[model samples]
Target: MSLDAADGTESADRLGWAWPDLPPGELGAPSPMFAVRHAEAPLAPLTLPSGDRIRAIARYEDIRTVMAHSATSRNLRYEGAPRVTKGLSIEDDPASMLNMDSPEHTRLRRILSGTFTPRQIEGWRPRVREIAGELVDTVAAASGPVDLVEAFAFPLPSLVICELMGVPAADQSRFRHWTELFLSTGDASAEDRVSAALDFAGYAAELIATHRERPGDDLIDVLVQARDDDDRLTEDELVALVFGLILAGHETTASQITRGALRLLSHPERWAALVDDPGLTPAVVEEILRYDGPGGYGMLRRMTERVELSGGVVEAGEAVFLLLPAGNMDPDVFPEPESFEVTRFDGTGDRAHGPHLSFGHGPHYCLGANLARMELQVAFETLATRLPSLHLAAPATTVPWIGEALIHRPVSVPVSV
Candidate 1:
């Protein structure tokens, strides 16, 4: 459907553009508008939720080029750069890595790199499996329909992140609440956003101080030492880095766990296949990442210099949105992209499958990708092994979705075990 057609009766009165609708009955499928734009206007001008105009890059090659190019920066603080919304640009925050580019981004990322290495994340697998198993046991023992998101998806990652960051057990729920409010897209009021930001910053400062006085064997302590002993991180940067880690460490994985479970339950055969052969868990995890990863779009990139793309010439200082979901569904890359076959990435499919861009590409690829994979792998394995009879309590269509957010996820997944 055309943009106007998709907008339906609300076309004339809308304040900002609506995101392309997901294809009917195919959760996470690229909206028809995405395909149309890829063919017609690969770099189509679009209005942001902030009502700012940007060239939305829809094609896989164009999107990849923008992400991989050093000239296209994530730093929104540059004078006259375009923003996703009107408020405090995360770029303006001294503590936000989301807004940093180049040497600075590399510096902060280096500090945390050792913590999230594949070996480090792999070493945490036993702990992750134990956590997943306990949550699954709770669901298995429940008497009636339980919300999988509340019971399993949210807490497993929340606890794991808390452990990694050395957050006190009692403070986890508060951190989760702060994260939800802080990460709000257009839905949260400016006052709410400000309050969340202040609250989280204050809490992080206190936590960092405590770690300084009595360092623990956690990521936070490692950072605190880097700041105190090496003087590598400034006070503001330290606080911001820790805050960013807390927000990202759990929120994305929680969304994936909830969505992945819903995807499996929606396709009983797929769920059964995984239950029958647990060895397929890894392939299933990759397919889940490709089919319906939580990331709805790429982080905003502003062109530092004029660049040529298939769409057209983008002048310096213009912002571009890399539409990752659309690239994930590109038929040129994956055969029958809309269908969610668990084995599609296992070399048995008709077409050779390439890596999905859900975690992003290039220098700023997600730092938590390895940890996220481990959490998801354990989540599905535990579900299939312990609660083999689990099924959706409500129709998949009836599950409510959070609107106007960068990450697309169901509010809850009601299930019976």
Candidate 2:
């Protein structure tokens, strides 16, 4: 059944269908439906969890074309543009870089780029390691099976981002709830999402005010002092930026760590290999990202003008969903894409697999890629070393997944050391 038909009426397809489906028994594999769509309809129409119907671009080249094209925009406030969810318009949050286009996005991204540079992120390794170590230590000390998502995965990135922003650790739980609500898709009601956004913005405003007064040695303080050619971020922008960073910075990485551990534990051989050689942790992390990145698709983009693709022309104002997972699994890009081989991304030259779109490409590529990688690497290494005997508390197939979200993650990664 077509996506439109599935959306129009209650049907069996709706139950079995997911925009980016992981077929039964295929944990990290992309749905075979993607391969069919990629070949037969690169720009196939699909319905979002928000019930918004839009064209989905699943082929690697087509997805890249749309992402790299200057005419496509990330801003979703334009009239007639398709939206992921109601009450989640970028217009509602003007300070968010996610809502900006062109000069504005460039300006805001430039102001914040310095903080996430490779060098700066590398310098954060020790602290990230420290955080991961502490979390792993807690897991080790647990009396019984522990949900890694609650114990280690979620808190590691949460604590790191909280420290980076100088947010009190005590308030981490509150921020977690706010971010989950804000980023949720079908799981949350429109009123709930709006409430979460308002609460977060209010918190950010107060935090920014505090930073302005105290001016600590944190990213928040740096942002307060940041200027680009004498141009400074406005109060709204500052609050939005911090709110965006806090939400994006931790949530995605946290999901990755949780899923990565699950991937390793599911594949005992790979887990054993990593335990035998910690150096493979980076490669393992990369493979995990390629296989099961948190996001099902890249940010929604609106076509500013007609753009031709393998399937057909995408007219102006039409929403395009770049299915990142589909692109990452394209056979043309990665040989045997279904196989989760850690060494696939290891070698320097021809041995290395092509880059995956998990972090995205072009202008809006993930700003926190380096930091995310460091956290994932440390997470795997620490888990492999500190809890070499760690295993899933239940069968991998039985683990619950939060499928109704912009980013998919395990509800909880239950494990025992």
Candidate 3:
């Protein structure tokens, strides 16, 4: 299955992408998109629904090229950029560090740097271990079966983030609801989304006020103190930034943990192998991230100027979507890329994992990668040790994935204690 090139030659028409109107969750499944773009043509021009043009960087090298390119700007304020969401003006505003270009991005990102450093994230390891252990115990005490997503995956990251942000444990339920509404793409009620954002913002504002009077050692307190000490970020920016971090940090990590567990548990051999050798846990974590990480692709970045990619020219402002899963399966890079190898990169052949773009690449790589890794490493080690015989209670294909959600997740992974 190949697409005919515009040049009317078979050689030029090397790729054929059978991308269709499937729901978001289903898109990650083995689709023609992978078979065509990754197997046939690594670089291909794709016409999106809105008649806008963008190129899909499917091959590992191509994906890295796009992510590492300077011409690409994460700023959404560009003329023809993908709309992240309709609710917030930040979707198109170049204010968020994730949406800004060089100098401004550098300035805003620096504000977040001192706090989210590797040292700070690594310091949270003990707490992450404690949270993972506590959650596992809670589930163990609960009798027969447990929905891992609800019981463990969802809360561990959420609680850790709340603690870090100085958000109270009691407020997480409402915070979780609002974060869901913001990231949802299905038929979510307009009122639900807007109302949640307003309430969440008001709550953040109140939290900031409280922190100002009584400063603490949490990230939120740090931000507020920074705001006071240096005229760096405004009150609104602080609110938005914290809100963004809370949502981004928790949601993606939760989803990945849930999905990764299911991915391994469904294959008992993999689960057993990890249990047999706990050291393989880290490699397994990386493989899971590469295999089924949350985030459809990295953030939507726009072309700052006219640029040529894959023998096609993307005019300035056009947005490019780098599908990470496709890149992970590229044959040129990873031999038999689809197969899950626990020790995938331990002195293998000439090919390495080739930088799974799951955490993304370049300066905008996930700030919480270390924290996420710590949480995941602890998660697998503990779960595998405790529930050695743990297997998916339900069939793999029957497991439901969260729909139209930014993070890929199983709705409820049922497991017997």
| lDDT agreement with native, every candidate | 0.78, 0.77, 0.69
The candidate that wins on TM-score is: 1
Clashing pairs in 1: none
**What TM-score would candidate 3 get against the native?**
0.87
Task: Rank candidates, lDDT, best first.
Answer: 1, 2, 3
Ranked candidates, highest TM-score first: 1, 2, 3
Off by over 4 Å in 1: 7-29, 78-80, 347-353
Better of 1 and 2 by lDDT: 1
Name every residue pair that clashes in candidate 2. Answer: none
On a 0 to 100 scale, what is the lDDT of residue 341 in model 1? Answer: 83
Better of 1 and 2 by TM-score: 1
Q: Tens digit of lDDT per residue, candidate 2, span 220-277?
A: 8888887322557877788888888888878898988877888889889989999999
For candidate 1, the per-residue lDDT at 5 reads: 56
Pick out the ten consecutive residues of candidate 3 with the lowest summed lDDT.
12-21
Candidate 1 structure quality by residue, lDDT tens digits, 220-284: 99999888899998999999988888888888999988888988998899999999998888888
Of 1 and 3, the candidate ranking higher by TM-score: 1
Q: Could you tell me the C-alpha RMSD of candidate 1 in Å?
A: 2.8
